[model samples]
Target: MMISEVSEKFDIPQDTLRYYERIGLIPHVNRNKSKIRDYTEEDCRWVEFVKCMRSAGLPIEVLIEYVGLFQQGDETVEARKELLIEQRTQLKARMEDMKKTLERLDYKIARYETGIAQTEKILRRPET
Candidate 1:
């Protein structure tokens, strides 16, 4: 598909797609005779993977390294597995921290809700 189609399908900006290709994040995209990017299924998959990893807070540098290793073929299979395992470990730690933060936010919101309910009760009481 064309860049615009890929951008729309992935909900990513066209410029960011270009940047990803330029940075070796998504690998080289094949260009058509018109000099326009023609993304294959594999290209789309890479884009999706990168977007997911980035959203999960994986560092760009780490992803670049992973992609480089991936391009090196079967000889780097063990290396790739190790890289993913390390990234998964770090991601789990971040998820734990985020869960704690979410709990704190929920606590604060519940407190405010309880306070509002109590105020409403008082306001409904008949004035002496």
Candidate 2:
């Protein structure tokens, strides 16, 4: 299929797809005589993977490095595993921080509710 088809299928913009290809996030796409990109199923799969990584908050630089390693054959398996492990660790730490922040917000919300209830009770009393 063509670039347009791939973009429509993946719900991604055509320009973004082109940018990804230019930046080496996805492998090189075959070109037709008119120099237009002709994407194959494999190319589409890579594009989908890239979209997933981006959605998961993976940095573009890390994706680029992954693509490079992927193109270099199977010898970089350990390095690739290490990269994923490091990212997982960072994500875990971020999740922990978010949990703490959420707890603080919940506490503040409960405190505000209590204050509002007390104020309502005071307002219901006979005026001085």
Candidate 3:
């Protein structure tokens, strides 16, 4: 497929795709006879994977390095596994923290609700 197709399919901007290529986040894409970028299914998969990892808070530099390692073949398998494992651990910890924060927010919301209910009750009482 062409670059535009890739952008539309992945819901990513053209410049971002170019940036990914420029920054070594993805491998060099094949070019058509007209010198246009021709993305393959594998290329699309990589783009989607990179997008998912980035949205999950994985740093771009980390991804760039991961891609570099990934392109180096089987010798870097163990190192790549270690990197993914470490990121997963960190993401899990962050998710736990976010859960705690959500709990705190829920508590505050309930408190506000209780206060409003109490105020409504007092306002409805008979005048002295």
Output the number of the lDDT-best candidate: 1
Per-residue lDDT over 26-61 for candidate 1, one digit per residue giving the tens place of the 0 to 100 score? 999999999999999999999999999999999999
**Candidate 2 residue lDDT tens string, 61-109:** 9999999998998999989989989988887898899999999999999
Q: By summed lDDT, which 10 consecutive residues of candidate 2 come out lowest?
A: 86-95
In candidate 1, which residue ranges exceed 4 Å CA deviation?
none
lDDT of 2: 0.94
Q: Candidate 3: which stretches are off by over 4 Å?
A: none
Model 3 lDDT per residue over 1-128, tens place: 99899999889999999999999997899998999999998999899999999999999989999999999999999999999999999999999999999999999999999999999999999999
lDDT of 1: 0.96
What C-alpha lDDT, on a 0 to 100 scale, does residue 10 get in candidate 1?
Answer: 94
lDDT of 1 at 46: 98
lDDT comparison, 1 vs 2, better candidate:
1
Candidate 2 vs candidate 3, TM-score winner: 3
Q: Estimate each model's TM-score.
A: 0.96, 0.81, 0.94
